[model samples]
Target: MSPSRVTYAPVGFGDYHWTVTDDDGRPWFATVSDLEHKEHCGQGAVAALKGLRQAMDTALTLRERDGLRFVVAPVAAADGGPVLPLDDRYALTVFPHVPGRAGEFGQRLSEAERDQVLDLLAELHGRTPPETTPPAAVEPPGLDGVLAALDESEGPWSGGPFAEPARKLLREHEATLRERLAAFETLVARVRGRGAPLVVTHGEPHPGNLILGDEGHLLVDWDTVGLALPERDLALLSDDPAALTRYTELTGRTPDPDALALYRLRWSLLDVAEFVEWFRGEHQRTEDTESAWKGFTDTLEHLATASG
Candidate 1:
């Protein structure tokens, strides 16, 4: 498609987005993912791209082959691949701009919306995943940095404006963070020991990724897609006990509290680690960094609250 215009869509985190209009006035959502960020996939650059390609392909299979319509997979490029290498530092993928209202991150879904999502998730969990799909990640990316930050006896980090503040925050909450990490490790052991079956899971199935359109509730963001335990997806709904109970009724498998806690702790730890790395890297005072600073402090507090 020939792009007549391209405008940035300042929505969501972790991936750059743009709305491209074709010559025929058709709108398409363009996503440019940073190859260096290993948050979604478990590795950097090459391996991350490979994992993402496999994940996107699995998304396509779910929509086209398995007839799972809720999957908002990427549109294949000219090379017939879901991901197109933009440069060494980034990759580009285009998606059909689904007409609907998109949800925000951390927005609580209503009961009806929750039920609908659980139904979609149930259908997803029941399907057999593609062979190319990678295994779900239990370890959060950048965890080593979080641990290292806690070990540091220095005054502050030297990344940029947020660096010193982030170090201070980490220092203040070091004890709670360490305790939570230990609890997380224990929970991870329990979940792993259960020997439960893994399934294709949308790693971040929060409201921000959900699109309430005429077609129905469509889930965007496929980078974190992988084969994992049902709890990985169900854990996002831990805020609502009823949703967990309903999901158990639908899938006939009760969600384990330990697994749920593991994922919850995982999310907070991952966020803290990612923000720490960002602030420690060569960054500057920008809108994004400011946001990252807020996220950094917020996640630290969230972890502390959980520990409390």
Candidate 2:
């Protein structure tokens, strides 16, 4: 891997640090970065970089010994630190450069492609179950935590269409549905707390992680890895219901609505909190975190709408 020839893929800021090439052409990626939230996927995700690194390392070690598919191909550690495209107190891990393009991935695919993906999932799903040994428990943010995360000086959750809706929903449900929500919250926490047979995930198994290849859909983006909490991972698909059906069809099961709701709202708000933190630091503009704000609002609206 030569730095002179490497040009980063133009997705993230900081010089798109990676050389995208076929396996034959020479595949590699590397970078050094400071802990700046905005430069990463947004502020919300930035704070978790350290936790993400540990999770990835654990995942990689599991893969090496287990030989998983969804997990990428990483090398042994270098002298300085972990062998990866990054090592900035956050992470640095690379894979065998899975060949494929995002355009080719699909949840709503032709019969053949869908079947292929299901088969691949079945095979991958067989190797390891959700991880139980090292339980990476995700605690539901209590009122104090959620409010604290939302109370950043000028983060995304503020003064956006999202805030109005979220606040309105909270107000509306504060009294009528408080008990139900508390119960639901406990259920959501319990589900995640009850560890699963840990399997390798792309961390972020959204459509973005999908890569179309001869072998079928190869998952990418091992940023958020650990156990396969389908509720959490699957809720990432709330923005797309069709994908939910496809997932259900493939798994021969339907996801629990309450659990899905909790995961969606939790992550969506977490994104909001991150956006707020990022916006305060990066730009002093009103509309900087509009996307997250919009998502936050929409999540609230969707939940309110669902409740009605």
Candidate 3:
């Protein structure tokens, strides 16, 4: 089968994506990302895609019941396979482009909008998945290795403008960083001891992943979706007490504060580590390097604040 005309989408970080138009002028979204980058996060491309497929299936199930709006799953190729391999460096998947504006991180949504989001999440958490779907494995935040990489790099650090700044920021924040690491370990132990029931979680449910469309709100970016304690999703919205209360009222599931704390710490640590790795490696010279450096520093501050 002939492929569609691909135009760069230029929307997200961490992946190369495009908007493709078929001969009939119907547009779809396509994503191409490095397999190794994903593997570094503790899951390879194949496993990540499999988990995404399962999560999309579950989301569709909830959509049918609650009128939940979500991004359409990647379409299988002519051979009936979901992922199409481009080469060793990149793999491809395509989906229907839902029209909407992406939400900003610090932007406040109105009460009605918040209720809609809570209702959607309640419906999602109430879903039951196939028995064959395994629970997501918990991986250490792996920030230590990232710190080591920064320490071992010999400088003149001039290969990238942000290189020296990133190294300095890491050193300045070292004590706070170590404290957050210890706090994460302690939180993990408490959460594990409680033995919360595992549910499918959209690992990163921040406003950046939400799309407010003509019909309703839609959650995009399922690459991190997997079977985990529901708190992993709830932690992102924990700033709003009313949202948390409404979720429990809607789903009849109690939220665990310890688990929510652990997940929030986990997000901050992982993000700081990822940005550091990106800044130190081949991505150092990219146009995004400066923003990446700022993000790393901001995340470190977030970790420090949360730890306190």
Winner by TM-score: 1
Better of 1 and 3 by lDDT: 1
Best by lDDT: 1
Q: In what order do the candidates fall by TM-score, top score first?
A: 1, 3, 2
Q: Kindly indicate the candidate among 2 and 3 with the higher TM-score.
A: 3
**Rank by lDDT (best first):** 1, 3, 2
Give lDDT for model 3.
Answer: 0.70
Candidate 1 global lDDT: 0.85
Each candidate structure's count of clashing pairs: 0, 16, 0
> Per-residue lDDT for 167-258 in model 2, tens only?
44445444323443454567666665754444443334555557787766766555455455555565655544455566666666555665
lDDT against the true structure, each candidate: 0.85, 0.49, 0.70
Off by over 4 Å in 3: 1-4, 40-71, 131-134, 147-159, 239-242
| TM per candidate | 0.96, 0.62, 0.86
What is candidate 2's TM-score against the reference? 0.62
Residue 150 lDDT in model 1?
82
